[model samples]
Target: MTPQSIQKTWWKEAVVYQIYPASFLDSNGDGLGDIPGIISKVPYIKSLGVDAIWLSPIFASPQKDMGYDVADYRSIHAPYGTVADVQTLIDRLHANNIRILMDLVVNHTSDQHAWFKESRSSKSSPKRDWYIWRDPKYDALGNRKEPNNWKSIFGGSAWAFDEGTGQYYLALFLPSQPDLNWESAAMRQATHDDMRFWLDRGVDGFRIDSMNLMSKHPDLPDGKIVNPDEPYQSGAEFFASGPKMHDYIREIRTEVLDHYDVMTVGELGFTKDEQSVSEYVAKDRHELNMLFTGDIVDMDFGPNGKYERDDFHPRKIRTITNLWQNAMPKFDGWNTIYLDNHDSGRSLSRYASDAPEHRATAAKMLATYLMTLSGTPFMLAGQEIGMANLGKDYGADSYIDVEGRNYYNEVLETRGGDVGKMDDVLRELQLKSRDHGRLPMQWDNSPNAGFTVASAKPWMTINKDYTEWNVASQLDDPESIMAYWKQMLSLRKEHSDIFVYGSYTALEESVTGRWF
Candidate 1:
């Protein structure tokens, strides 16, 4: 079908590669990926024909949530290198004509952050209002209780008790990552200053982490109990799209983002509905240029959440994709097309067959879907080579992600120490854990998959299939998945007006699994 002509912008037509720093490569053989390692792979990234790179957080963090818990937004994480290293990286990538997007995690800060430190000090401290704090409620017997029945995304209570201040502070993800109080004008200003610190250093834009989570319910009310076995409840309804979400988003747009010509893709962490998503990225809204929606990724989630899986229906893919592709363009809101990233399991293993005979074919189909789609496409590092999830045989002990570990312990406790139940959860973890995506990138069939020196132990395990799946073997093979991806990218660029600006129409709107 002929594509309707639309306004052209570099961001709208770009193919972005997301790099999870710790897993990409190790420069000093210190078993961790650093800026120098990324710099070393510049030519390889360029070879992919991508126009931009979205780097996951490199900010100073305590490593509690794998760099999501920012300890100092202005400083670089020590293991990843220093501010000077980041500057050099920006220069190198820009010299190659590739724009860079830094991860912005402002929904919360590491409990160890200087601002959080002051906020937790004395109750009368000037920065006390910088974080969400509420006095404890008491029962008839005078026992203190949490402020609300909110469950953390990682499991357990969302509110963490602080002994120093005799109050509880909100930590929606992990206890070490305390939610920042966006209600405070001073806190908002500080966030803007931190953003400028990076934009001034030449970052092209930001991949805002949990951007929708910036504004939370003002009342801090109790959530309805969804699981009788667990005391806390899902707090998404109240916190996802708070009353002031759009107001705060527009404030950032005018005060910070609008000042620079940069790409802004907000992560709608909890806001999944089409209406809520359109409000943040609609051209008329004066907000973000695009957003990363979780609808496609979360389609298989069961009532019990990510760890519990529902039957995978092929129809959901068609329905979900069509819904976004058909609706967003009407409102002038753009979409981010991706199947997997630093969080979910690999696309090949989750959405397509990963068996030896069909892996290659499934991967090519995924690439075709991503490139031929109606919006910007994001390719995760190592995805080009068909990285599959570490199989269930790796065992529970191999899981390193904090969220998976928390869920493991929570499930164990709730089931009264049923080892079998824990084992079942482990099976699910093998398929859903973020750690699978964090496995070291497979560069070649060498010690440590050429990710680091032979003697240095990697921060995470290299996938066992690396010997056969590394890039060197496929780089020269014309029929390889990586090669096919390169072809698709070239085709997309050659027909930019059709692929990027094209209006989408589902050819199989009523197609179901039975039809296959």
Candidate 2:
């Protein structure tokens, strides 16, 4: 079909369901979810009427950032099955007429990855420049200091000391997830080659993880301090949307994505402006078809990186909606609309009136608000079951996220190790934390939430009320959240004018409530 006769970008009207493979389903007796397990759920995914499925990182990894820190891009992790299992999934999804979008995590790789291992072995190695490395600053007292004033997302310095080279390397996330040096031509070519491998395997598209953060300013200037009362500052400006980001993205598009009938959507973390969104996703740019913006998600956090208990007002929500609606015209590109993801808490608890009595109604309302907007709707696993955030009793030790653990320790340290105060802080953080959404999917009320075998202990705890709020139970109930989501997806697919290419207008914005 011609570009104009395409009606709209396939992704524009599509409802994309995101599956965190590790917690999705476990076909093996082992506690982890795998590709074969995901294959078994194809009919259920198809039943939702969604056009595509976006699986989170399933590549070989140490599970440091769940699966974002890739150790091998060409193969699947052993726990999640092999590359052949992925092919089976692709074939089955194609048979069901559903597309697949694999995660592309080019920003960093696990320190255990061969490239990083070689880069760190010696400063003179050929791969030395593959990852960012620099000399540490020394105080007059001769104490070693970090290369910059940047703070890691996991709560400490972004730089990690390398004993072998007596230098520091940048890691915006966990220490194991070393940032890649986009300045290295060899690194870019390698990443491009990896993308081609997936495309050749019939994968429909890619969801670029931390895509905007692939590059950093060459000067590496220290950004303005974020919190004077606190020790470290947020150095997001120093690395986000870096100097050669557009050029690097264009290269990837031209070399890999543009060669196939693929759709690319980037996850933009540090962007708040519309111009950048337009430049990255505009038609014919060969960069991306859309991007996931975090302005809505940032509202839950205070300026000091703490949870904002009293800041969630209707006016704030309206302002966010208006900014995106007015910034980019409907036809320019698409947006990925979501209230929850693998890295955020469940929407039912964080956004809805979490009281059990009101959860379903509020969940549907939130769904209607987002699904009708002019963009592709993305639903995280178990969101259709109206899943709430894990309760307070779910301690920090139970989660695998490095950032969650760091924040828990920071709270204890700040409180002079007061367990009670630390507990309260941890509870609040968990209420808004990412680990809540990473829990095992609620398939049935059976043991292990029907996600794995009876004797298996899942990688994380299954939701306590999974028996009442689960796919099997809700699928037969017409008024259930799952049914509502199915209806919404069906409507979106049938009514392309309003849900696909329609212009967005904020109807209300004030202290009482916000409407769009």
Candidate 3:
């Protein structure tokens, strides 16, 4: 449908369901979820009454950052079926009147990606400047040091030495996922072209991954050390939402996104202020239609360091609610509010009261609070069933995430070699770790949680509580969190004025227990 023909701003009233492709379902007996597997589950997604399904990256990748490290923007990974399967899945979703928003990991690409491969081959290659490349800073002893004190989000130095050129390259996450230099005109065009390819294929929208990290400082400088208490400080100000980022986003909006009837939501990190949030998604800004903020997600992480623990309780809920309320009046922008995503642990176990007797009430309460808030609400896969974190004993090798495994070993070897302490760290890590959200979807209480037929062990173990939390059991229960979510979504569809375009005013402060 043309943008003009559409009577309402669909995004303003939309409910986006986020599916981590690897764990959602496994078809073709591969023990890994694929396009065909997702296609088979379209009916179940449609039953949730969501406006769109945002599939976390299914694109061809080295799987270093799982699917975030896109190897080929146009094709599906071998493990996740072919491009034809994606097209079929899109067709099926559209047939059910549901839109599909594919993940756009534009901030970076897998180091194995053709562009990165070519970029790394030589300093004079055509794509040499496609990614951030810097000369190593030599120490007093002539030993090569990282260009700056910038640290990777996954711990350790951000710069990786390239033996081919004898220079260092920047990787914000896994060394496998190298940061793209958006300053280059060719890089910008190539990224835009990638989006056009998907838009032309009839996909509806995009969830732009690490969208705010696209632009960086022109003259890379050594940023200030933020924390003396911690080992390394993230030089985010120099890299995140950098100079000319607004221009870059506006260019994409005009050239590619605005030309089509597509909803765009950016994934923003370390951005907690109203002004920065407003500029990205405000109506007149003409950048993204909405974006996910990290204030709520950051609650689980201890302010001191990754190893430290924090009590995440209902009182922390106010911090999230207040930020949204304050932000709503300042911008005509919409929010993509979610408690769980592929990066965080299960919300049921982390935020909600996970005790068996309390699980249902807390799950419903959390859903009610999130769904009623103004903006688009995104429900992570298996969130509707009150899925909790996996067992603490699930070993590091079972984890598909590179960062999780690295941290596991680092803590074990460095910190007194205490296995019990390691267990505590793992428990906390499980609370904040991305792998917890990447487990196989609990479809039924059958072998393999009904996710795959491979008989071979799934990459990550399915949540053991699957027996009671499976979709099959919850679908029939009137008081189930799944059923509550269906009702909440129906309310959103039925009463667009109150739930959609309505101004959000938190009533919890004035009247306790009521969040109107």
Cα error, candidate 2, residue 374 (Å):
1.1
lDDT of 3 by residue, 246-338 (tens): 999999988888889999888888787888889997777888887788767777677755545886866687877777765755666676678
Candidate 2 yields a Cα-based lDDT of 0.83
lDDT (0 to 1) per candidate: 0.89, 0.83, 0.82
Off by over 4 Å in 3: 1-7, 227-232, 392-400, 508-516
Q: Write the per-residue lDDT of candidate 2 for residues 1-516, one digit (tens) a residue.
A: 112433466767678899999889999879988999999999999988888999999999988788899999998899899999999999999999899999999999999899999999999989999999999998999988888888888888888999999989999998899999999999899888899999999999999999999889898877687577765678888799998999999998788777888888899987878888888987756578888887776666766664535456656667877777666564365676878888888767766676789989988988887788877888888878888887766776666567767787777787898777765566666677777878888899899889998898888878787878888899889999989988887787777786776777676445654444
CA lDDT, candidate 3, residue 16 = 83
Give me the candidate number with maximum TM-score.
1
Q: TM-score per candidate, in order?
A: 0.97, 0.95, 0.94
The worst-scoring run of ten residues by lDDT in candidate 1 lies at: 507-516
Better of 2 and 3 by lDDT: 2
Candidate 1 residue-wise lDDT, 1-516, digit = tens: 334535678998899999999999999989999999999999999999999999999999989999999999989999999999999999999999999999999999999999999999899989999999999999999999999999999888899999987999999999999999999999999999999999999999999999888888899888887778678999888888788889888998899988898999988886678887878888999989998887777766777689886756778888888899998877888889999888888878877888889999999999999999988899899889988888756977788898888888888888998777677688678778899778899999999999999999999878888999989999999999999999999999999777888878787544453644
Give me the displacement of residue 358 in model 1, in angstroms: 0.8
Q: Roughly what TM-score does model 3 have, to 2 decimal places?
A: 0.94
Q: Indicate the residue-level lDDT of 304 in model 1.
A: 67
For candidate 3, the per-residue lDDT at 67 reads 84
Which segments of candidate 2 are over 4 A away from where they belong? 1-7, 228-231, 306-310, 393-400, 508-516
